[model samples]
Target: MQLVDFFTLLFMLMGVVSAVLVAFHPNVLYAAVALVFSLLSVAGLYGVLGADFLAAVQLIIYVGGIIVVILFAIMMSENIYRARFRDAAGKFVIPTAVAALLIAGFLKLFHDAKLETRAGLNAIPTTEQMGRALVGPYALVFQYVAIVLLAGLIGAVVVARPHHGNPESEAEKK
Candidate 1:
């Protein structure tokens, strides 16, 4: 097998393992860290696909920015030790059924399509073109994303802040 194929397999494995850990890990902090690993693997996959800008953006925006915020949110929460991370058996039933249906549908589609293996996959560097599209035509959409992320950050901070009138704890005295 080629070196790129080997690395692709490795990164796919890493991403899947870490994603599973993110779902199944009992410790919230550990799950957050696992999510970071998963995101890094996705960035690696982007790099393997020759999307340099996408890889950089995935690393910077997701792994660097969002994961830090998630970590902070996890750490700052008061009942970290008391939190239950395991899901009940009944909770997984519907989701599992839905996932099975989706997988079966996808399989049927792929089987029916009988897609031919196309030779000479042209690798287009989309960095400059994507940048121009984002700034030129899709500028409104870009601004909306920024606004939503900012709002989410603000919401996180607001939710994490201790309530003033709650007489339950000694933390918020003001």
Candidate 2:
């Protein structure tokens, strides 16, 4: 097998293993860490598929942004640390059966499909074109999204801030 194929297999294995850990691990913190590895492996797969922009976004948005927030929340929550998480008895059988059926169906569909294989063709990079479009035609939509995110952040801060105006609130802080 080629180097690219080897790396693809490695990344696929890493992603699958980590995803399983994320799902089944009893510890929430460990599951979150596994989720980070799973996401990073997916980003690696995107890089292997020549989707550089997607890989970067996966790394930045999922791994960097979302995972950090999740980890911070997990660390900050005292209740989460004190609680023990476990699946109820006999709960796995149905989900396992469904997952098996879905995997079988997907495998059968893939085996029956006559998909064209692009073996040696180099993928033309579209990141530059996408950047140009985002800055040019899609700029307004992008700005609106930024504004919405900013508003949400501000709202979160306002809601999370302790009330200081009430006399009872001031007394409770002491």
Give the distance in Å from residue 24's predicted Cα in candidate 2 to where it truly belongs.
0.9
Candidate number with greatest lDDT: 2
At residue 11, give the lDDT of candidate 1: 93
- When superposed on Cα atoms, how far off is each prediction in RMSD? 4.9, 4.1
Q: Which tens-of-lDDT digit does each residue in 1-174 have in candidate 2? A: 988889889999999999999888888999999999999999998887778899999999998899999999999989775555563647878988999999999999999998645365455787998899899999999999999999999999999776989788788888
Error of 2 at 59 (Å): 1.5
Instruction: Provide TM-scores for the models.
Output: 0.69, 0.72
**Over the full model, what C-alpha lDDT does candidate 2 score relative to the true structure?**
0.88
Error of 2 at 132 (Å): 0.7
> What TM-score does candidate 2 reach?
0.72
What is the overall TM-score of model 1 with all chains considered together? 0.69
lDDT of each: 0.86, 0.88
> Which ranges in model 1 have alpha carbons more than 4 Å from their true place?
87-89, 102-120, 137-174
The count of backbone overlaps in candidate 1 is 0
